[model samples]
Target chain A: MTRQALPPGTLDDTDRQLLNLLQEPLPLTAHPFAAAAAATGLAEDEAVARVARLREVGAITRFGPFLDAAAMGGAFCLCAMAVPPGRFDEVVTLVNAHPEVAHNYERQHRLNMWFVLACERPEGIARTAARIGKETGLKVHLFPKLKEFFIGFRVVA
Target chain B: MKLDATDRRLLAATASGLPLTLRPFAEVGTWLGLPEAEVIARFAALQAAGIVRRIAVAPNHYAVGMVANGMSVWDVADEAAEDLGARIGALGFVSHCYLRPRSLPDWPYNLFAMIHGTSRDEVEAKRQQVAAILGPALRASDILYSTRILKKTGMRLVEGG
Candidate 1:
């Protein structure tokens, strides 16, 4: 399907409702769409259509289950790097290719490049790093999350 | 998003972590002193209101062997940022990507993309690749490595007694 281009900052109430729903899905139930439609005061078809539209517009990145890797005995850490002026996209592409890499972001700092990699075990993290290094030819500074005080947040629009 | 009492109760129960069981909601309902159906209903409402983003597991990267992680910030040309941001978002390594209003005199970066790696060295290498793609148009960029994680929890939709 040809993707429709979204206008800048063009979001209606239904669009907002869709974005909000994608962030946190309700418990999977027999009538999930019906439940959501009731809550949003829209028809079930409208609720479903809104979500699909959001995905099409690129507003909602991914709508899926959030897993607790820690509970599954997986190891993860937050790391960052300082990239020169001219290689952000190339580096991002290389880093994103790794399966273990889960969450990546750009923050305000000298060590500008940052991402999180979650692996089956703690040892696998190092190997993933080495592979990324080999692929990109840049020194990756491994900053394992030493302590986790808190980890989840939601932005209400 | 204004949450009702039912919404509040549901959020309070599932905010930290989901019950790992076959009947998770039933278990959660028992803990919260509510009926399973009610808990389920409110949860659905909370999600629709945009109050509860997702009920999912937060992975421990360290435990999984992803020892290194970082927040990669970029200074892309204002004109090209939306396009570049979309491309970065599509990358698997990038979990979160957004365009924040640049903080003048404090933070100059307008676009941010996060990438995760097992080791710090690995993340650094990824950064170089991103830099190459950005080319000469980027004005400045930085990586704020997480020294400590203060708090991570779902928003409390209900008020206290």
Candidate 2:
């Protein structure tokens, strides 16, 4: 079984149901929240308010449409770099400043700094990695997805 | 679907998030000066065309305390990689599984799976289960646990549009 920890918040049964419902594809209608309200047995106003509260408290990172970059003629790749310990902070700032860098993380490995680079250009991943390497003076390793077996995330609420 | 200027504008308006209101589509329409019905229709069309994967909430995994994230890389036979990948991807514990190009003479793994758990031990156990599934087909594998999230945000097409 997958291990999971309850999110921090004063949540009740209603909130848990709401979280699960929110992960679903919302109805695209004139009154979409109404559908959510119906599912959660809460008023439309209350449902919207609760979602807003969840976001404010950082329980929900984002609530909206998830766009597919590849389908939209964009490029993306996972990259890693081994930055010197002394220059880690400076390199992080430089890497994050680039709009092309989607997300980055520090991992427990020799090649520590890992990030996602995404852009509309077909060769954007390579170009961005090259630029990051030149700018940070660290060797950037590109790990682009050759094939997708699965791509989805769901947390048991 | 080919998104024109108007479609781009609409997506730009809600790229960060949908307006927190009873009628988010209508609100977006108001912001873009387009009819509410038109906005709703276009949004639906975008989804049908697969440009928009879905309208949903992305929960904060860390905030939820499922902090352990292990990027498991495996060296599987090139011929059987696809079949094994499909099986691994179907596992409930594997949040993301993909076949990534590996750099030869250095990085030798190709199959990658992003597994999440509440702790390192949990993630390691999950990795073992994945190995058990792979059996002898798994030549080699390694898990890289993320220590910190330096930056995180979804891909954006337009810059603050």
Candidate 3:
């Protein structure tokens, strides 16, 4: 199922190394790229340029502080809805109308539609879910994570 | 750590991204009228409080050929959920692992691990690894393949300004 998107030589060894390395926690120092460069045996300028190029090519989505909304008195909730196939488009329109919805994906399941709601306050999750329910006339199941297991997660780049 | 007005300003400024420069922190500071040292200090403090998970890179799996993203959910025994969850999360291929509430008859999976691969078969293979890790504790499992993206407007800053 792997479709070769780029040429075989598109991503060099250094590029792959940086991609994997950058996934780990970055230093909080003023010159983070400088630190990264030193660790990866690259010049600071080159590291910056290569990262920028990766971003330009959409090989990476973002590189910055990953904030936990819950720590900032905010909340992120995973929500799902089993929308009828015929009303799927209309329901999506109504659900996506709320600014709280970060992203919505249609999945293969009876409870097909899944999305995440990032809210400033925890209460906002319930409020937005209720509003979406009323608007779409569908039951929205909120699966706010009860516990998150910290993983040594590394994206396959 | 409670976020003050200045902190919120800093967050809102860098929410989109941290400027990619030799002195990226200083560049972010310039936007919020803070010195580089103070910006660094505040971030350090916030990070200590677990507010900032990390400063890192996020690879777009889709763009990198790991386009097959599967939400492989497992119904593990409740008593052993947390223990098994930790094991599942530690897998190199598992991106996110969360122990969530099972919605009874409708849904019985409590352990959710996001598995990504170059193809669905690869994803399935990874899922099998997870199931194997789960072993007898795994009662049932299923994977939901995303059919489409209904919307992708990205996250927003809540109204507080």
Question: All models, DockQ values?
Answer: 0.05, 0.54, 0.62
Q: Residue A57 of candidate 1: its Cα lDDT?
A: 51
Tell me how far candidate 1 lies from the true structure as C-alpha RMSD in angstroms. Answer: 15.1
Sort by DockQ, best first. Answer: 3, 2, 1
Find the candidate with the highest TM-score and give its number: 3
In model 1, where do residues sit more than 4 Å from their true spots? A1-27, A30-157, B132-137, B147-161
Tens-digit per-residue lDDT, A37-97, candidate 1: 6778887777767765655455543443343335324677655567664887788778878
Q: Which stretches of model 3 miss by more than 4 angstroms? A: A1-4, B159-161
**Tens digit per residue, CA lDDT, model 3, B1-161:** 66788878887887878876788888888888889999999888888989788888888777677777889999999999999999988888888899988886788889899988888999999899888888998899999998888887776665463
Compared with the true structure, what per-residue lDDT tens digits does model 3 show for residues A1-157? 1223555676787888889888988887767877668877999999999998888777777878887766767689999999999998888889888888999999999999999998888899999999999888888888889999866778766
Off by over 4 Å in 2: A1-9, A84-99, A134-138, B158-161
lDDT of each: 0.60, 0.83, 0.84
lDDT of 2 by residue, A27-113 (tens): 888888888799888999999999898777766878888987787777889888878889999999999999988889898777789
Specify the CAPRI tier of model 2. Answer: medium
lDDT of 1 at A31: 43
- The alpha-carbon deviation from the true structure for residue B95 of candidate 1, after best TM-score superposition, in angstroms, is 3.1
Point out the worst 10-residue segment of candidate 1 chain A by lDDT: A146-155
Q: Candidate 3: what is its chain A TM-score?
A: 0.84
